[model samples]
Target: MTTQGENIAERIKAQAVSLGFAACGIARADAAPRTADRLAQWLSEGCHGDMIWMEERAGQRGAPQALWPEVRSVIMLGMSYAPSRDPLALERACDIGRISSYAQGQDYHDVVKKGLKALARWLVEEAGGELKVFVDTAPVMEKPLAEAAGLGWQGKHSNLVSRDHGSWLFLGAIYTTLELQTDRQGQDRCGSCDACQRACPTNAFPAPYRVDARRCISYLTIEHKGIIPEEFRAAIGNRIYGCDDCLAVCPWNKFASSAAVNKAFLARAELVAPKLADILDLDDAAFRTVFAGSPIKRIGRNRMVRNAAIAAGNSGNGAYREQLERLASDDSDVVRDSALWALQRLSDG
Candidate 1:
């Protein structure tokens, strides 16, 4: 060990907390054998679905050595992105849309990665070593690594859940050429709690600790390309972007906090529970204006409008037929098909 190794590690950890990460934990740049095998099995089971990229860096995801040959330690950090209110409550207000808590404000990738890079740069300058930072951008298995590092335990939904922040934390990792003291690993605390599994609108979790991304509403609205499967449409309700049912039902929110540093995390008053009728009227420009600087901007106008059309149809309100009918001729098959489905739901109702 170097003369100042412990001091360096302490400084790094302190600086991370100062940077507003709710919790920080470190692990040796080595693989946990059981976790490694489990990851391989998950890939083989094809649960990742349309996310082909998850398979690309399969080896590096589980083993830090696969990322950098000289990496001596892994520092995993968690920032509590938990909102002050429950996102699930909005679901019962079916006439209004329900955006996942994480997306209610700003895009986390930008904020979390920016903080990680700051800590990384500090390490290079103060510790005399090399470092790399990863947010959600790379092939990092952040949740597993964070769990191994002891920041939190993986809940039944397979997302990392902290006793402090619940399932509302965003995770990032830093790889370094310096050795650091590792944390005690946390155990699975899911117990008999199946709230996350039950809260899922589409039954995405076929079993505990496993999520079928193909059947997840978050996947359908955000990642999965092409028209969503017909069976999931009605169950999707008014969740246009992503679903947070699994995260919200965790019993840990009593200790969770509002993420104050990220000012953009404050929910946009209008977007939080926008009416399906009002959202469906947006053209491309209007959508851009409304969703600018938000994660929803990534999905574009038609996709969002298509979701609104479906929600309108499910609203059992016949007045929205004109708007839904106009979208039926849309060239984008996704929008057109959703319009057709909405029209049918409305007519039948």
Candidate 2:
């Protein structure tokens, strides 16, 4: 005989699938007890780099009940954004900028949150419970929660890796007052494979499951505010928006198919491999216009141009020298600084 809670859980998952969620799993509010301590340690070590928000809500982020006392269960959902082509294919194209697969399409924050709210409404009608939804904006430790909900385990790269979706799942959570049946926790299957660690251009992974975000190309390009450290600039190469080296190298991706990816996450043609010259030419207005409705818009023109300058320098193409010279006198200090460095690099060669 099946319990009422089990039936509700199954219905909730089916509803999530109908709403375009690639995966859905549930766990008790306090499923992952160690999440708090691990997060505390990671925060204490400054592994989050310049993202001060993580420290602001540390307590609430680690424990779901701490954030919402009424919450009894957590429902984790994943939307697959698996790339159609090799993410690292643009590496040899020195004059082109490689945008991370996730940001190449519509902003995931909007896409994932829309689905979450829809699912929350369906649950309210079906099970009659108070609920709250969250995406990456919240201080929530989504990967750990996903693991506790049996979606996948946090892999050696410190990213949730699904046997079915690989490392390309966009996570969202629904904390509810409903006491639903919970799923078993996901188990680690990484074994002795260290492919993710070996693929990092900047050695971002300090150990099997710990990532020092300070050394991560994605952090440097998108999160870190001021100038990027000199040591990692060359290693960043043509990747201006974000880096996917670690995620792309995971062996589990063999099971991920582009067919399973949501249409909202498909790569935009212009962003797949944009020319460095065009990116460097973007002023504030141009950048806003070009990236409208895209996640890359949040970084703004200054950071984007600064990143393009660095990639231009690494390109070793003399054709970019004039653009770099013009950008050297740009208004933003970071953009000017990066442009000057690129000019110097070109002059040296």
Candidate 3:
């Protein structure tokens, strides 16, 4: 008694699960009025930081149909990268560096996008419709669409929070012309709890569900191309790649499915607690080799070294003086400046 659309939708969900997605749902492709409004407000407030692309493609990002008019249904998928242990264990591991759990393995963009493309291929073969798959690269408002599709709700930290997988989900979206059945939207369950906001090292959250990237450790370390402000340098601590305090402190993460179930997200031993000295010594070629398939590779050597220098300064160990001194002459002005600042902090200790 099922309609063709219902049958196709059911099969697609099954296929997505088989393809390693932790959760899958469908939503009608339409303009997201609320998301668009919030994006406009966020942009107007200059909260996007150096991510100019967020402004450049605002129209396409605001509405799914604007990116592809033929799209009738959006297939939303969630891949769990939940960590097996506490992500904050290294908070005081001064001599060692910490990488975000999500970035501790092969880039999720490649892994999740591969699954999305496979699902898209299956949909085309079975349903005979045009489709497009996106995994973070495009101007797609993936989190909003994922929530609309019932995969999860956007938590207070502005990231998707899944009941089954917690805050450690990697999101992907597929747009298709097929008129698929849509799922009911997920409800906001974050009522009253503000653990994520209070946990921020830099107080990056201007308010619940709003973030100021200019003061965000993730943005300062990964996106900003200049010297990090002295004000935030100490609070940055040893997080060299990305910040995880907000996500780690979320009460929802207690329900996170283990890493064994999410094989692709297993933490690499090398990234777990990399020696700051070793990282500070990496040149361009060494940096590429170390982060070959990791998300940290995107920032390249200068930025990674720059972040490492900041961590060294905050270490207060004073043992890293030689390494920090060497970096004081790094070719990149930003790295050189950070290294000089780090040397001063170490000297004053």
| Per-candidate clashes, comma-separated | 0, 0, 0
For model 1, give the RMSD to the true fold.
1.8
lDDT of 2: 0.93
> CA shift at 85, candidate 1, in angstroms?
1.5
lDDT of 3 by residue, 1-349 (tens): 2398999999999999999998999998972458888999999999988889999999888889888889989999988888887889989999888888899988898999999999999889998989999999898999999999998899999999988888988999999988988888988999999999999999999899889999999999998888899999999999998899999888988887674255877888899899999999999899999999988999989999999999999999888888888888878998999999988988898
Candidate that beats the other on lDDT, 1 or 3, i.e. the better one: 3
Cα-based TM-score, every candidate: 0.94, 0.98, 0.98
Evaluated at residue 66, the lDDT of candidate 1 is 77
Q: Candidate 1's residue-wise lDDT over 5-69, tens digit each?
A: 76777787789888877788888777354666888888898888878888888887767777678
Error of 2 at 20 (Å): 0.8
Query: Model 3 segments beyond 4 Å from truth?
Result: none
lDDT of each: 0.82, 0.93, 0.89
Candidate 1 error regions (>4 Å): 1-3, 259-262
Which residue pairs show collisions in model 2? none
Can you give the lDDT of residue 187 in candidate 3? 83
RMSD of 3: 1.3
Lowest lDDT sum, 10 consecutive residues, model 1, at 257-266
